[model samples]
Target: MTSLSPAPLISLTWTDHVTGTEGYLVVDRLVRGVSSGGLRMREGCSLAEVAGLARGMSMKEALHFDADNPGARYIPLGGAKGGIDCDPRAPGAYGVLVRFLRAMRPYVEHVWTTGEDLGLSQDLVDRAATEAGLVSTVQAAYPLLDDETGARRRLAEAFAVTVDGIGLDELVGGCGVAESALAAMDRAGVPHGGARVSLQGFGTMGGATARFLSRAGLTVVAVADVEGTIGNPAGLDVEALLAARDAHGTVDRGALRHGDRELPADAWLAADAEVLVPAAVSYAVNTVNQAAIKARWVVEAANMPVLPEAESLLAGRGVTVLPDVVVNSGTNAWWWWTLFGDIGPDAEEAFAHTRRSMRALTDRVLERAAADGCTPRTAAHALVADRLPVMAERFGWYR
Candidate 1:
């Protein structure tokens, strides 16, 4: 008799058109016991991309569960992602957003709990959940806002500890790009002391990156959001920019005095800078824009921020591109450790282990890439693939 194989997790897609724009909800992998993911809103988001992200989340969780902590005894939580292909910048965007959320209400009630993602805010999520009456007992059991803030703080703290343990300084808050850029610069020997930095996207990641880079002695020459680009060759004050930034991450126009110009959204890519970090959406650095990038190094803090073709193009131009999987895995791994607590009684020690592991992984990948003249992305994949089988065998996943 043949042994029964486990059922493959289900992926669901739903689409709706409202206010003359289309929206999609893609559920990637649903662990039968617990499930979670986020919603992404942008003009070009597709079901395929959302589905792929969900699957990645699943793999992320699986790896965390299996290797990070062995005795957590926690069942798998399925992963899901939703995307809406509506420009959040347009008029009536909020209305379409509400409709999109309403359409996915049933899923939110039963098997999924969605949080903020690209172009989506926590306020919007709370509004949608409240409107749909899908707020869970867990959410209702505590002081709503306090619970969210507390959890986020704890997660952020854990992330900081993990990074510090790895021998890297704590990430200067901004987006993932700031952290990734720091890592890339450290590896590439780019001097931060007098480097001029330009950033596209001022959201949590971008804004944080600017502030951190500035504090670290890098001169932030330009910053751009969906609204426009602001520049000052003498270096913009990150603190002033942060104060002027609105909730959507756009800097207030009235607060600038310098070489600021109202340029196209993509203009930030061409700005003169020693380092350019894209902490915005995926595919921002595609074929068309690849030729325009002026930075000596491009560090992607967002998932798949550069298309493969763009990466090839940049590589040919002698640009060093730091892959997201390695750069941001530190944050992902920390979250998993927090959720499962598999590191034994000493959370500090466990976090230290995570940091050491992350730094070691980065060093190994960089060393291999240099030795073989390969891209960091390729080296990362090769490293992971080689180690995974051994990990599986040790975990008893195979006899």
Candidate 2:
């Protein structure tokens, strides 16, 4: 069922002259001479981790391919990812980022189209890209686009659009995650009004997911950030805490009410809830900590958040894990949809597309899981296995 190679198509490591920090780029695949992924900056980011993320992106893109649908303008591209081994909060981190981008400029200009990932923001990446003398982070895609100017304009407008003070770009991905959770709950005969959820990380992805799930009538019982976990049995005021977040996505502890309890950093793993979302970092849930989870479902809102061994353990315990390739793919798909004219700059249209696509995909994965008696991750990989050959037949294996 494993379709992708263990080794990536191309791998490069760069050492920054300013900080001597390492950066990595792994192109998992390429379609039409272009590949898409995000640039993540974090401490201890290894080439192996970047390679895993790159492969995950390949699956994420392949999962969305629909050739028979005439209205589907978004043709999923191949996967690539970049990472830097430095803390974004550390001194001279920006310098390292600029230098890293400068070194990766050739790929960005030719083959790789990237945006922000963990420990970095799109705005920060855009600024760094500008300083690196690059036209845009996604400029490589311009050549493949039919009307690059119009697509660029539409994307910019979409990025500028906001709903209730949250950017449209940020909400679409979370909307997909929330819908996947809802679809699973519906399949399991659980009511949204009664489901209690706990999540780690309050950044753009996690915060937006909390907003949508809260609006959908789910009680967000706990949320964790760098400092610690904030929990309330009665459900914390999601809006108030959202308003109190800093640029780095950490919620201001001073904003907590009397009912909100600041717990230990790992408290979210053991919180009394029906659903758990590890939206923070890679390998957040390992075999040892998997025993602490009592939730019926663990939805990965972060890439590679759950290790394979941990996932196997959770599956043995009757806990279903919705894989990251399926759960967190909305934002990437949304970008392509808008750029390729499948969707527009309007928030409502974007949300509708994301919901429809994510719900259908989730249902398909879950149904296959049930029929095959396998994990959702296995089912998802099987689905990808069935499609990659077709895409390769049409587009060819090598770009």
Candidate 3:
């Protein structure tokens, strides 16, 4: 194990509002590194959750370094997350959001750069950035779209043209939880074509995932946003849904009615499908709704979408649950590696490289899990744990 320095300490502070509610800003494991993870915001976000995500970023950086030719040394990159506690669904929340951003401007500028996440839109991010007088570059001018088609087009073409020597055909599996789910399905002998799918979120990751699966011949039957859940067993119009979705990740209610059923807030989980993607928020599949899940396979598109008890329950019911860490790590990895601008030709190439790396990593984890008779989650964690100590040692943190 490579050991160098101790993991840096992180701190968080909560500020109370006049309504007796509180919001938090958390810093986790800063390496005095060149870049820091983007800030994510959502309701009911906790310090522990932010810390966990930050730690994941650290591990991701370490793993990327390990994979470098001749073994790249660790660079000083850090992780941080912040969020407000109020419901973004409420009226005049924009003003509240502005206030929150302004309040944290000083600290944010000093240590972190905020980015879009659940309950936060790119438009919102730009507004916040503008208000804080932060520089707005790197495709920040575009309107928010759930599908992220532009981003994906860049990512796909780049991977096919730049990274994979065999060209686009060899760029079969990309990355993220979506790739992990695909890997699992391949392992279980489940065919991809005509498979029913229902997605709970329609954000950048969720929308891109839906498109990827659809292109691969899966039938996306339902998609849910914060506005409402829309289902059509005959297959949803992914393009139409994308067109109707607003900046807040909510779809317009006035859109086409095609024997569509409007389900309750959590009804997306109950949609009959071969695969269910919980891509919206954390703990969406908690104890309260564990039994309601009917999908044969649940792929976590969001961080910690499934609770421990819920996961165990799903396992007992013969439902496979793919872990979020390795799945979501694709985008996270791309973002981090691109910090140096030396990763590839453009952002798209960087993202494609990230996908390839993630696919290979997921495949190895799945193979090891099957060979060792353990869960994919267990095997992935074991792989990371085994490597982290070595990385720490190589950096002289351990003696």
Q: Pick the candidate with the highest TM-score.
A: 2
The window of 10 residues in a row where model 1 has the poorest summed lDDT is: 164-173
What's model 1's TM-score? Answer: 0.73
**Per-residue lDDT of candidate 3, residues 224-303 (tens digit):** 88767888898877767666766555778677577777777777888889899988888888877989888888887787
Model 2 C-alpha lDDT per residue in residues 1-399, reported as the tens digit of each score: 136777788999999876789999999988777889999999999999999999999999999998679677788888999999999999899999999999999999998999989999998999999999999999988877789999999999999999988889878889999999999999999999978999999998999999999999999999999999999989989999999999788999999999999999999999999989998899999999999999999999999999999999999999999999999999999999999989889999999999999999999999999999999999999999988877777775445
TM-score of 3: 0.78
Query: lDDT of model 1 at residue 184?
Result: 63
Tens digits of per-residue lDDT for model 1 on 339-391? Answer: 34434323456535554545565676678789888998787656655544444
lDDT for each of the candidates? 0.62, 0.92, 0.62
TM for candidate 2 is: 0.98
Off by over 4 Å in 1: 1-9, 17-21, 30-36, 55-79, 89-113, 136-176, 259-264, 328-361, 383-399
After superposing candidate 3 on the true structure, give the runs of residues whose Cα lies further than 4 Å from its correct spot: 1-8, 16-21, 32-35, 59-65, 71-78, 89-114, 133-175, 342-351, 394-399
Give the range of the ten consecutive residues with the poorest summed lDDT in model 2. 390-399
Residue 37, model 1: lDDT of 63
Error of model 2, residue 351, in angstroms? 0.6
